[model samples]
Target: MFPSKDAPLKIGAFCSIAGQVRFMCSGQHPTDSATSFPIYSRLLKQPEPVANGGKPAGITVGNDVWIGNGAMILPGVEIGDGAVVGAGAVVTKNVPPYAVVGGSPARLIRYRFSEDVILQLLAIQWWRWDDEKIKREAAALTGPIETFIERHSVAGTATK
Candidate 1:
């Protein structure tokens, strides 16, 4: 994670970040500047960075996300829950929940599950469940999505 006083990298629970996975929160070149050079930062005499109206900032990774080896996540990119970032992917944009993204400036390859299932999981938000609840449903959590949803859905109310 690149250190930025202003921009922070917020990671959620159960993330599997692989080797060389970079969360670049800092090192943003002043693209709005005329020359795209940080004159103030480089030269003591120069004034502060030019007014770059829109600068990308921060990285947010949600729960159950798996970032593969050598993945580079750029500033202001948000990886949602259950998303899979492929190896060596350079993610420049926000990845949606349950998405499987790959390639340079990563594109959405697919979602891990169908829309209905994704919605069900989002609503259930099993990752946020208490320790006892998680332990009680360990088998279902590790098994199939259908089973998990069936057991934990609003109608089922497995928690109760």
Candidate 2:
């Protein structure tokens, strides 16, 4: 529910947040010691001590990210730019840029493209472009990798 002031939740532009995705943002009950009832609720009841250091680190989702329906993003996960979180995925860690992840504790299934292409895309940073430019370059953005690269290539670029 709450995003930390220090690292507020950063959901980048053009990102698609699907329906029923849960962002767990606040204090979690202590698992080390067994409790009959939730301690966090008790803390909420009492404000004198102001217990449980408010909201942990915020989740950061980068530009062009696609979070699928019913995905549960736990606190402190950093989903990188252009990443795709599959439906019902429970993200528990940092997802690398352009990665496609899925499963209960989401694992990287694959990357959308080769490292070189990813690098090129990162460099292009199409998400940062102005609306007019983005519209003008829609074909390049949606085109094949080689075509896109050819359209916007820096001379002497080499791929591994």
Candidate 3:
């Protein structure tokens, strides 16, 4: 129901893209007294178009991210790279890189890593590393950050 492989499209890791990810609006409705009644009726009768109670926008997911089962990513939301959205999270805003977010409104619990370490990892761009190289470094990948850095630090650089 989407473009074929020949077309250029972006996909992320472990995400279940059921509906229109690019142009999905959780569809929020205003709560003013004048508008609320009609919206409430519409919501009771039919809820799909009014997912976020009728806001309109699209969602953008970056690479290497995992969106858990039954998660509802709302419109105009941009999920950054290496982020993890827990199951049943109703994301209503943009998620930063490597963030682990959950809950209805989706508050930021914590970053996946320290800011400096995250920056280093981003600069390393290890996601682009070949499978074999990654496999060789699998132990280090699962090891402490300092150990990984010490072992995999740039050539000719002192181990700090």
Which numbered prediction scores highest in TM-score against the true structure?
A: 1
Off by over 4 Å in 3: 1-9, 13-57, 153-160
Candidate 2's TM-score reads 0.81
Residues 35-124 of candidate 1 have per-residue lDDT tens digits of 666555467543343254335677999999999999999987899999999999999999999999999979999999988888788888
lDDT of 1: 0.84
The positional error of residue 131 in candidate 2, measured at the CA in angstroms, is 0.4
C-alpha RMSD by candidate, in order? 4.1, 4.0, 7.6
Worst 10 residues of 3 by lDDT: 1-10
Per-residue CA lDDT of model 3 for 1-160, tens digit only, reads 1222222234564344433323234344446434545454355654324454444444667767877766777655788887888777888889998899988878898999878666666565566788898899889978898787666556543222
* Better structure of 1 and 3 per TM-score: 1
- By lDDT: ranked, best first: 1, 2, 3
Better of 2 and 3 by lDDT: 2
- RMSD (CA, Å), candidate 3 to true, equals 7.6
Q: Write the per-residue lDDT of candidate 2 for residues 30-122, one digit (tens) a residue.
A: 444455344544655632112333334568899999999999988778998999999999998999999999999999999988899888777
Q: lDDT score of model 3?
A: 0.64
- Looking at model 3, how many pairs of residues clash? 8
Q: Is candidate 1 or candidate 3 better by lDDT?
A: 1
